[model samples]
Target: MNDEARGAFATRGVGLAGFDAPEARGLPPAATGVRVSSASDTVSRRALAHGQEQLRDGPVADACSALLRAAAGLRETDPAAARRALLAAASAAWSAGDHDSYRRVFAVGPCHLCGAGCASTPCARGCPEAAWRDHRIGMSAMAQGDFRRAIAVLEPRLHQVTPRAETDELCDAGSVALLLGRLPLARRLLSLALASARAAGAETAVPGIIAYLACAELREGRHAQARAHAEEGLVLARRLGQRNVAADLSAVRALVVSIAGDLPTVRAQVAEVLAVAQPHGLAQAAFLAEWAQARAELGAGKVERAAARLAPLVQPGARQGHFGLWFLAVPCFVEACVLSDRALDAPEMVDLFAVWADLGADPQAPAQLARCRALLAPADRSEELYRAALAHHERASGPYEHARTHLAFGMWLRRRRRPTEARDQLRAALVGFEHCGAVLWAERAGAELRAAGEVAGTGEAGPLSSLTPQQVRIARGVARGATNKEIAAELSISIRTVEYHLRNVFAQMGVRSRTGLAHLLANVDEDHGRGWELPDRG
Candidate 1:
């Protein structure tokens, strides 16, 4: 190729040396008919090797560009070598956080490094190049907020990794799992990643893994544990000068504090998170911080403010598509919208949440969807939707959400003039909120209870109070006429377990039949005045 033509290719970030002379379209030949020799090939190979070495040690983007140039130079003369160089370039670009470059290079087609026809066989098992291929695909999917695809790409290869696999592999898999609402699997994988990072002294990996663990724990309703993990991760990230990680950890802390009803602390933490995240282009951190700030506003009874803050986030917008954490914000946004008397805004939010509900495979999605529907549904259907939401929330094992559902249901019941039934749900909400350290919610529940003319702690112990949270849930299910099998399926537990819990619930509530159980639970306050007692099976 002529110097001008080669220079043009280089300007476009393509290496021309690897292009065969015949295939160098739009390029003029050298001034003289110069024949390429083996000596020239050797020089090109040396240059490619040097680029590869730089990829391993130097600045990633520069190394990536150099490697891509080398790959282009060898593309026609040495296809296999060119493929290897391109793969190295893609890897370097990904490592440098240039996902666009990675995708651009991979769009050239499957190479030996990614296996023949790799893009079409994303889920193919046992391919020799599966690990690297899936990792690249998974990371790309995650960056695009296509978490279901990311999980599908990563979960299969997780067990195949040897002990030598990088801690990031585990961290990425765990994070995808958590986003999918596979909480148990996420917890297990994140725990392993944390252990692996600590053992290998991978200090840089520790903070990100810990941040994920904190999120998992938060979803699982282990508030204190979540806070501790977030605090530790935040400290480590700041100490390591990992500004993005610190920003993410700060956002996590904001969520924790918001749930705990410390609005002031939540606001402060969100400010810190946004200060670091927005300037650094940390989209995930900024999204989370804004979500947490909205939650804080909601908890503080600033309904209009919360609704305004959350509206843009839940609506179809630039920020909404980039962050898959929208699932976590939906319930709060739905409530804020309804409470602010802007129920018209709910349809779009509900539609967006419904899309996630369909794709997320999260255990909590059904309950959250039901809750959103309850908020948007007409008065005639709202009660049924609320009941369905509560049942699903209980089955999903999110105590904080379950409590919030109860609070919503209690408020609804109170408005319907069923104060006695309202008090039952309010008391349950109060207990759950207090257990989760959601002080504001607990106080709200307490206030609702008082407004129902039920003196706090003055009535005889309600039969529901003696039951475990699980039993109370089962009792409510039975009251709603859900069979044990149906309850089992919804909760992701065995029918036998549901049956056993129902029996305990029946015994505790002094009811021998489902109908009696339903009646007694519905009019629980009637028995409260009579001091109903369970017959001890023990």
Candidate 2:
């Protein structure tokens, strides 16, 4: 329990005339401190808001009031329960939207900044609208891959926004809007913000503006303009000495470079960005940049490395909050699963979409979610998912985003052996990648094209061009017929997983059987580090 609670209980004597509750005598009381702590921040505001409702209909006030007390209990000792309380409070606030309800439900809950009257101090200070609260909630929702919900949580605050808020929060909202294809909204908000930032000479805001302008231009299909704007942002970020902003700008640069088909540069630069961002405590920047880097590794013929680097960041637990949490995490996770040769199950869009509905973001998330499902579904189960992803992307309206969804569809089609449809998707994806400077992605698409016989460029096969010393060891083992089990045992894998990798090796190498693989393997020598020999099935 917290000091207050300990003190509250310490009055065990009952004889007191109350003398400032004579300081609790002894050690720092080893309990978790608060039944729920940080209650003063995110949760208390919600409680205070709940109090407002109690003043309204006596019944709800009682229910929520009781809920608030219980939440306080949880707040000091168990934050998880506290968060649930806060979320419930937020839910009630939405249901009520009245001054009392809004205050008790959101404003007075923990995580509240400034004061219950946060709106009152817009002119004098830090962050208008108290963006930290909204952004945190929105980001938490997004990190769970709940963009529709994030928009819901964030939009009310963003709409008719006052220039008094921090620039990053505004930029974040615009970025999410652009990703969702709320074009008209994105344009209005972004344009206003950009103009305001520029006029204010807030150089820090330049990067945000650059992002908005580039993203806006890309949505309009003004591809070249998008590139230029992104480039301009990078320069401006450097001029301002804002490493985080520069890193974000560099991510855009990587995207642009990827679009230009400069795969090597895209690979190198994204890695640099990841390296630069990881140590700065800039979790959002690090996660985003790392994701791009992993994708680049796949494009560069280093599949294993990509898998290791990406798996954690995309996991839901690893990305509880930040920004674009879901939109950013889901696509990258899905992409990682497919490229890394794993089944797409846990946390698939279908599952995540359900969670979104429960959270009450955009109601349409479920319907749009069906699109991604159809797109990823078995060939026979797909017409629905395909249309959904298309609709979702169109609604998202950003070409870069649309292209990614299309690329996923192409991967599905290719898997289904519908080369014609697959080629169309792959081409569109490459164009998006090319258009957005996702060079590494374009390279992968080029490989798929060659595999489909529409073109003749190496994708992940024909040679191991980008393998590092570690990968060379692993690849050589596969080339020598070492099963993942044997390779794992030799390199240390369990029997089952050995078979799993064997399947992937065949698919990645474009071979149907061991003999065929052996034939392909003959071209390489031990110089790069050969793997253990395999037992011939023959």
Candidate 3:
């Protein structure tokens, strides 16, 4: 970092964690998750030959030559001419086996310096085509959201540095590392690359590198440092007139603000970003910015508005694999849990936490498992599970992954009737999430304080205080838009029995309609430690 950037970070009490050597490399992955073990036939070889023959000369140059030819055939004034040119060039490059050409013509145009030295530069004749081919494929993989695949392809290339190399391999390897959750390695490698880019005056690409460093801080919970680097990168991007990079920086800034709980500012900045980024057809930035804006609304306790905003991003059949969308669910569900607590409405709210934990656990390591373990009711029954999950998460991504894990673990212990243990876990989680600017998440920590004094705080409304499991079950069924008949049928009881339970539920929960029944009962988190355990269901 320059003196200014370093000073800015120091001002925020942030420091570079310093570099450790690279981690052990894993095997390269395929373009898609679908891997084919079968060998290619002679026909595939012949097709590659024919395609290469189409561009026997400079691969990129030949691809451009094909595009220029296609565009010549279209009328100069034709509105569709640019698109037609692009399509035709892509087709020709495919035919010519020009992978670089195909990507330039077909893919989102960025990373402009990829093909500068794919082959052996000092060799009397360049290295074999297959040797250079994987890098071309790797670059394309990185452009896609397939981070695992990108990691695989770049691993061998990173370690294969030789005398004839035109560009350092560490730069590309570091880029992959950033995507794969290895932040320190990414920062170190990217910083070195940025220095070289600056010295060479490749000003075009510096913003991307700076953005990477900013992301390192974002991951580590240094919001201020991240914001500073992101802002600086934004200025550089705009100064260089790099719209794509600018859009990207703007989106990250919006995310930072949202995470910080600065909703009003996030809303305004995101609107500005969307307006500019959309016109440029920067879909990733536009989409992510919109999602982040909704996230801010969710954090601000504006539930309905947040749900509406998240609709597009989280809609069913939406192109999946959005990490942002997944993480945003944390606040959304927590808010739901809050509303449930306020209204005493949704028992499902508490259960939803369990579901979320189960969904994320198999893939998470031990330390992270601690977070999942938090989902269980505090008791001896789940302590082993919680500890096991913690062990897994910590192994996978270190202990300090996010505050939710700690806070949730505390809640789990509290539910298990381990109040002191719960208190300690909740306190740590509260402090951690608060420090990270995850306000909505951090605020939930106060629930533990309320939990500690819950008995003294609540008056026993006699009948309601003594609700039965069957009654709570029937109440939830009614609340879920189910008719008495459906509830009875599902519970394998008579309709009269269902009606009887419903009356008891309504009287106990204090509500008329299913909506009121469910909404009001969210107040059950107040059941904190009341010995109000439901009978075990078979």
Candidate 4:
């Protein structure tokens, strides 16, 4: 251990020199004030201490065992402590991919002592105890495929989580919320826990919370923010000697870079994650690493390579990746398969993706699923599917994906000898890609536009072209004669933000008034042969 790690362990009363010595087993030499009334208490305390040491050192599977022992020893005497220990054990087991150990932790009922279960008590809504109980029951229900019950039990509990909740309770609730695909709720709860943990100097908890927070941001299409948090979390995890958390953070970085079209960075991050994740049985991290690599390949236009890379991860049976994450790769897999002349191999994955999409967790899934179906549909039917995909994209915040749909539809139109229609979609796609910093995708769309007999515009293509996705939406709202408050409510943003983007929109479009902006947009729509629809305020 390094000086920093030793110092952290020292704060827990564990000395660095004799951590593994038989005589230094229970309560380190620095421990003096601890009270142990019974043999079980002493053993439980020792086991808990040892488990924490192992977590900070190496071999998390062993840490799970130690924590489980601690929980069992304290089950009857110290129910609260036992519950904490068990939750810790479950986390360790999950990281180590120890299925039996994880199941064992969950099998120990919601309450450590009460056989009547957690519902029997009339606890206040945001209490730490109630939060923990809800987390446990919700997780168990999810494991059992009772997703409806799980969401019913956990969604309300997420709202109940407050700054007053314990760090562990907050982390557990946030993680559960994330797994259920509630990105906003997960981000809010995890961000709160992260701030609280940082303020409390809880270094051990910060890395994990940051990992989850990065994932939530990633899912929400905040790629830049996700990468920033992932990088910070990686540094801290490595410094704290938490290889598993470091691997997870590295995987997150890989995903972020993959979307940004940084192939070299994606490969490097995936390599770093896999070197630790594969041997440590960190399947979630490993899955992410491999998925990111495939995504990078797809973005680089290596269709066959991407399809081959994703095969094992998304296919059924033992070779498949993490259950929660495998479906995420299915859209890419379907597109790759179609592009590689292996369309027959895509239906199963697309069906699976649709099943998950129906669960309504991932906001991008519906549009992506539509695109996948469009890829597999006949040319006669593909246009309607692509249109449906675009309609779905209007409701979500993922510009990269929305652009991909436009790009695909444009490509399809070009092949059908409809250059004019193709040019419109390709132009929108190029703008979307450029606005989102997807350089490779933007180049692809530009090339398509050029091939369709149009010189790609050097800078802004039109008045609305220079505006961002949000800016464009706000401009459209003005054209539709909706007030800033109406647009803000429709977009779930503050009216202040709506006004801010609107001012930028007006400035960019060279229009001082909403009436002028609306007239300008109407002229552009007539020239372009398409209409930009805003949310219907009526």
Candidate 5:
């Protein structure tokens, strides 16, 4: 075998003779007297090749079963080769979404010809093929939404391999980081992966890497950059005939276009994505496409349609655990449920969001959980929950999410006959959506503004108008005679964040002193019917 193929087989835990030397390399020796004759080796190689060919062609489940059977046949004669075959089988099981089978194969150490006590041996220590075994287990964990475990298993191994191997490891680790909402880490890791793939001449890996980077940028609210990445990834995916990667990129592109209010393009892209993904059983891509469809329906004012589309995704059952992207879908699902008067159907999903939020690793989860709570909150408690959600979004620096909270809060205020406050929020949401290229949300905010009897862009723009949602909160706190520490406490933000926003507020308001800021805000509030209460300086 060539070096690349040898590395690939080795990485799959398929130990070939003369390559993976356990005793010679000072690793734990395999069972004694379990030698494979030359003919047996040839037959084993043929079986491995057939299994790989089947995987490349399709029908991954059948291929996995065949590999497992082959491994069983070789277990007594050649434990090392059997272990390799088992690794491939476990990986195939994972790819086919057979979590049960994968767990069955990987949850314990392989039985070296000495079946007894083999389970007690540490897989990593007793097996030279531990890296591949751990990688397969990590991937299965990721599919099951156990991101913490996936990261733990995969992160440390990124640098302990060839560039080609590092490319694959980086991609996996970066994907987990992205799902965990570690944007900077995800970006850094994916960038390195892309560079490594290029250095290794692994052109086929580039599209997948770029697709992940697009997702990271999308969550960061860099819509333009995300679109750029998605577009390039799509082109490469098509050129390489990688339908799965193409589907992923298409779904991402559809989401971007849907947010941009291009309903026709969104619809077409969704169709294309689903068409490719469903036939291949690409659950992640299908989920993303359905999510984009629901978002498009919501944008077009078809709340019921949106709710119907999301029902299967959010409803309790085995399906929930099947899609790792479900966490990202929670906010949209909650909005749909509430708007369609089906809020009662989502109590369980709300609980799920709460659990994810309690984990507190993903930056977006807390804000999304707060939004779901706000939607489900009683009339007396709704406003507080909305504000809390907005504060969480602000602290996370998620402008897109902050705008979504603003839009929801504005609609609630409008229904409560608080038009001035509603207009303020609506205007902010409009500006935020527009800035982020969320054309559909921008239009929705504009409609809400008109409903509040305010002409878009006609209201007198105050200095505070230019401030971000977070800065405005800080400015209001200062105008109310609250100190920085108090503002931080009230907003659930760091003291440093409060101080930073206060500085921005002062600069934007062109004020040199707190008194000056308070005085100016008072005048602006009165002039613009802001309805903010200015307390005595005391």
Candidate 6:
């Protein structure tokens, strides 16, 4: 683990108190009437039923404790039932937003048969129900920054082709997958879990699963899908009185609308989420809500206000956002800092972002990192960095992020007296924003284009603008004397795809050769009152 990761955990007061404590072998002190012994199956079953009843009624903390105790009582008699009970405990703890209770239940201590906490795969003592033991150890390893071991241990348990596991079990795996940055796996698992919940008439489980699925889609850049799922989940959650799940869904909706630059909707969703999240200790929901607000602020050009708003969340402090979510917003925070001329205040967070980028969890991390470097780099170095960022964006999925990069690069070009190139980049950004329904950002790009001496959406229908965005990119690559292979590499597409686009580019422009294409582009540049000059990437 990196220093930033360690610092984040330390700041969050995350410790293995329950994982190593000997008292973990017994039922929680607050949990009464649960007798745990080798022959307490009937008692354990009753406790489990009571705990489930508590989940539907009230006092969720008591339910978690009771479930944990029931799991212990059933451990020696029925391994499957014990696993189910433990899974229920995890669900109850999560819905209550009780992190401490979650940790205490899942971070089981030493094995009853062996002194060690089943640190080995099979447990040298051949402990009964070693799967759950290994799972607990793996979870603890993850909490303690040993991700490699955790993945090795826990990943296999979730590898079933068509998982028919219990709803809570699937939900647990889905949550872990998300935390590990395995977006596709998280989506698949959670989707299956949602189906299972619905089929079993587990209405109480449905809202939380939908919330998780929405979160997965949001991170994967399926914003419209995320909003739909979040909206559905929010309705169900509110109807069921599951305020914590409702808060999470509301936060997800806020984030989705924020990307579209809908400030009013963002503000409304943020208010709804914070009202529940802050009072219920839903740190994940609160973090997403704050991030959505900061992003809306940044999009609206309130850079200083955005920076100030994000400082407490990204900086190392007691009030820092949830460890899982704070890193996701670091790129935005870095942009706000750079735009506000508080660049020096961001290197630490950037270093943390570097750690996140290295994890390869987020598909857009590489591009965002490049953009951050471009923002921080000197003028002589920033252009190539911006180009590098654009190249990275070609391989990523987020249209909003891709547009942001183009907008930034265009602003830089315009400031450098490269008005022609700035117009091209700003126009692309405007198109991207429009495609994604980001009205405010599209307007921002339009204004930038106008400031660069090219009237936004009012060109003489230039040949280059007539081409599709992909075709324009291919045509530009050809005009720059780049080979098909080179264009493929730059665009993160196949050479065949580049060649196909290039053929269409030639036909659309009525050009017979590369030289003709180049000449035509040069003529377009001359029309802008300046001869074309190759960009000096150095």
Q: Each prediction's Cα lDDT score? A: 0.64, 0.49, 0.48, 0.71, 0.65, 0.71
TM-score, per-candidate, Cα-based: 0.65, 0.51, 0.52, 0.72, 0.67, 0.72
Winner by TM-score between candidate 6 and candidate 1 = 6
Tell me the tens digit of each residue's lDDT in model 4 across 1-538. Answer: 1444333222212100000101000101112235445986988989988887665445677887888788767755676777667766766665654545554554424332233244324235555455555555655555444556667876786787787898777776677677666778878888888988998999988887888788888887787888899999989988988887788888888887886667778888898988887666676678889999888877766667789999988776677665445677889899878776678999766766676666565788899989999989987889999999999999888788899899999988976889899999999999988877777678667766765768544233477667655576678788988877766543434689899898888787888999999999889888878655442444
What is candidate 5's local distance difference test score? 0.65
Candidate 1 stretches greater than 4 Å from native:
1-108, 113-115, 122-127, 134-153, 159-166, 318-321, 457-538
lDDT of 2 by residue, 1-538 (tens): 1444233222211100000000000011122444434544556545544543332222332434544554555544554455445444432322221123323333222323344333212222564424545544554444334456656765675566655655544554555555444556666666666777877788655665676566566545455666677788878766766554566556666655544545567667777665655554334445545665555554444445555666665443533322223333444455444444554542343354344333433323444456445545666777657757677656443555566666667766765668898788878888877765565456556545544447543223345544322233345566666545434433222457556656666666677877776666665544445433222211
**lDDT preference between candidates 1 and 2, better one:** 1
Encode model 6's per-residue lDDT on 217-308: one tens digit a residue.
87777888889999999888889887766777888888889877677788888998878765555566777789999898788666666888
Query: Which has the higher TM-score value, candidate number 2 or candidate number 6?
Result: 6
Name the runs in model 4 displaced over 4 angstroms.
1-37, 52-57, 97-104, 108-134, 457-538
lDDT value, candidate 2, whole model: 0.49
The whole-model C-alpha lDDT of candidate 1 against the native structure comes to 0.64
Winner on lDDT between 3 and 6 is 6
Model 3 worst lDDT window (10 residues): 13-22
Q: Which ten residues in a row have the lowest lDDT in candidate 4?
A: 15-24
Scanning candidate 1 in windows of ten residues, the lowest lDDT window is 16-25
